[model samples]
Target: MVERLRGDWPALEHVLVIGEPSWDEFITTPWEDVRDPAVLPALRPDPNDVTLLIFTSGTTGEPKGVMHTHNTMVAANDPLPERLGTTPDSVFHMASTLAHLTGFLYGARLNVQNGATCVLQDVWDPVEFVDLVERHGITCTSAATPFLHDILRVPDLAERDLSSLTRFCCMGAPIPSAVVRQARERLPGLAVLGGWGQTEEGLVTLGIPGDPEDKIVETDGHPWPNMEVRVVDREGEVVPPRTEGALQVRGPFLFVGYAERLELTRELMVPADDGRGDWFDTGDLAHLDEDGYLRITGRTKDVIIRGGENVPVAYVENVLYEHPAVEAVAVVAVPDPRLQERACACVVLKPGASGFEFAEMQAHLAEKGVAKQYWPERLEVLDELPRTPSGKIQKFQLRAQVVDGPAG
Candidate 1:
């Protein structure tokens, strides 16, 4: 990866390798040496000083580095220990990449801050996850929605003793209602909570234990402490509750700025009446309930317009997840000469399941009372959906495949 980027980022000076020997041309240092008491400095920096730069996942476009300050990072995770019910004896299991904000905050930082034991996994395997939970007595963990689906698909899930696993905070995508319902039926001790956030804003909202089942599955919980969320139309005016619009957020945890992209950062910010340039446009379509809970409808670019009608991709995907055969699913737009674009439900079936035809899918939609125009016109079965490391389905890849023609 370094070699591939060397040409474009020629100014890159040094590379430090952790857990592995550095290449001959670069600096080599032991991880333990950096932590030596003699070499450590007692330094106190300003809370506003930049502490980290986390890059966006770039599922929609190029990744940009988001800047976070010391104060912001602390504000981002301060509520986690109490919110997640993380006691000193609680064990945190992490399977997602730490490069992402969710993994960095909940997996690493929160564990250290809360004085909880952490179990790390280099790669995700459902069986291994169950084993680790059983062995370590893991009490809580967070991951993308797909991880939950994969865990549920483990053939021996019923045979495993996963009572130690109590809380699963799901992010990256909307939690399919069916997945939540099935998880409750299968693991009565577990609470599968939904959440919403991005690298630009750390943990904007999270579902808590004891929320109604409908709220846990349908909404992405209420906003984090001191964070304000608003739904607005194209004109930047606030919309009525329960109405879909662009989601905007402003809080102490919001990124300081995009690293070295001041102009681009300014464009994404909205001026607040309090003379603070705070509100950051999230580029997500969502609605706030009367009680201020959020339901992410879709991304601004992920929406599919079929014959001038908008198809709710997330809603459709959630409904399709209820089908017994679907192990995983993604609804993407397929270019259509007439309708501009049409909905295609790309599905991954369970090991021994079959008979998922386009007509059968249409019948299922009809049974669920989905509008005829919103029903997917085509069905594509694949071994798996293309996903980012954080387990977010890369819809752009599926759209590209559809435009380029079917793949074998």
Candidate 2:
């Protein structure tokens, strides 16, 4: 993996390899060098200068390097610790890769900002997570929703002491209400908060402490301080409350731009009309309730149109997650000769579960009161859903598998 990474970027200068005995072609640093503490001076850099070059998850296409200035990075971390109740005494845990925004911003940066203790895990294991919670008194965590789901499925969960955990901020993807309910039942002391953001914009909305369960499960969350979100029509006009439209964000937490993609960045930025700064098109379909809570329905490209009727893919997937047999689900648009497009639900069943049938799927949707038009016409059970390294579902890959053949 290290060799592949090196090959991707050929601008060679110096390579530092730790823990290896020796690499003849590179500088082999000893483990002692990494472990030993050294006195270092704090060097202040320009806040407006770019400091972070993270990449998008690229669920739909090729990944792009997202540029972030020091000002944006600092601003992104400022409101998080307060909202999450993180303190100097709190112990944080992070299992996601630090390269991703969730891990880098919330796991590493937020812990530093709060001056709290953090336990980093290179790999995700639910059994290990429970043990760490007991050993380290881990009080808080911010990760993808699937991490929370896996934690709920861990065997010997009832025997573990997880009282130290309080806040679990689930981001990267929509939180299934079923998974949240399971967490509530299993970890009564833990608060499962759903959030929405991307590499382009650091956590713009998050559920706060003491929020009602409806807000915890149904809506993503309220906007963070200095972050503004609005739903606009295709013409860029603000839509009324509870109306689904493209989501836009204007905030200090927004990234500077995609590295070397200035024209693409400008194309997504909507010029300011009300004296406020320009709004960045989020490429998400969502609706805001009158209370200002954001509920993301689906990605604009992920929405399935059937017989001129739109199917909310995320909504249907959430309902399917309520099924006991379903471990993970992704609803993608399948080509249809007559309707132009149809919804096909690709699911991964829980271990040792009996086979699921199309009738059973439709029955469950009916029981959930989902509109008939929104019901997925077909169901495909796979061993597992394709996911990015950060656990976001690769729906584009799923679509290719469902429509054409298995993705290479």
Candidate 3:
């Protein structure tokens, strides 16, 4: 970059670099306070002009740097709080990696946008998280279904003074209605919300404020203003409500393109004759309700989405982790015309724990309020969990075990 923009990119005003001893280090600026952790950019470009480059997780392949202009960031950040009823005083938290859009763009931006104190923790410790919330009066947090479950394990969480908490929202997994209800009852101060977003569109969908009791847990809220979402076929025409299709979103929050992968970018954003703008077809399948609420079903490529239901393989695997008798598990979908596809879960038991029953897991899921239909039909015990260097679960390796094989 220094070589490519040798003349165009002049000296920077202030640079705050986050130097992680192990993880990849990142450099960011544009703040008024110029420090190591926080940098102040020397040049003051117009908010609409400054370009922000954020990295994408790239579970599909290598990590991609996504480009976003300041105008794009502001457009995505501005209206979020009111939709979630967050305030300047609200201390936002998220366990998800900040490098990801949800944590980076939304969580970090909230601090700057509201002039609120931002808490940065390197790890997700439930005990420490609750302590920080109590210590700092954190009001809003974005997380996944598993994080909430772990927090609920804190004994008598309901009795704790979580009064400062205003918003408890999650993504990347389905939050069971029971979990949401329990959370609301446990943390009466919290307005429990289930949200859905992709790295591509910058986490734009949210559940409505004061949504119906069932709606909050059952569906990811609705689209934000100025975001045009279309459930389209290969031809790209809009589909009606309740019909699952490739979730195509074109809006201000859209990432410019995959960081350095130009070929992939071309395939993703190949525009029509009119030359309107980029339309990112988030591989995830989702549908909009009559009232415009968006609910994510499943990934378009990984597993076949039966009807409109999203059989979240990851969500189910996370649930298995909550079982005391279980050690590790991976849920994968197998092709089945009758059900579109049926799920099979592979598990590894604790050293001493044995006689792990498939029926028992079904009962466990039932008790936990996981939809019965979403339960795995077959179960296989594995020796260990396959993971990447980053410790992320490798679903592809798990998927290979079930291919051309009998269930379980």
Estimate TM-scores for all models: 0.89, 0.90, 0.74
Question: Per-residue lDDT tens digits of candidate 2, residues 1-408?
Answer: 667698778886566565554454345555445654442223447789899999899887788899999899889989876788778999988998999998998678877887888899888998999989999999989888889988998888988999999999999899999898899899999999999998999898999989988999899999999999999998889999999999999989998899999999999999997987899998999999989999999998898889898898888999999999999999998898999998888999999999899999999999999989999888899999889999999888888888887521
**Candidate 1 vs 3: which has more TM-score:** 1
Summarize candidate 3's per-residue lDDT along 195-272 as a digit string, tens digits: 777666676678876888767865787888888777876677778998877888787887777666888878887465
lDDT of 1 by residue, 260-370 (tens): 899999999998889654799999999999989999999999999998988998889989988988888988888889999888889999888965888888888999998
The prediction achieving the highest TM-score against the true structure is 2
Ranking by lDDT: 2, 1, 3
Off by over 4 Å in 1: 1-43
Q: Best to worst by TM-score, what's the order?
A: 2, 1, 3
Question: Please, what is the whole-model Cα lDDT of each candidate in the order they appear?
Answer: 0.87, 0.89, 0.71
- Cα error, residue 166 of model 3, in Å, equals 1.7
State candidate 3's TM-score: 0.74
Once model 3 is optimally superposed onto the true structure by TM-score, how far is the C-alpha of residue 121 displaced, in angstroms?
Answer: 2.5
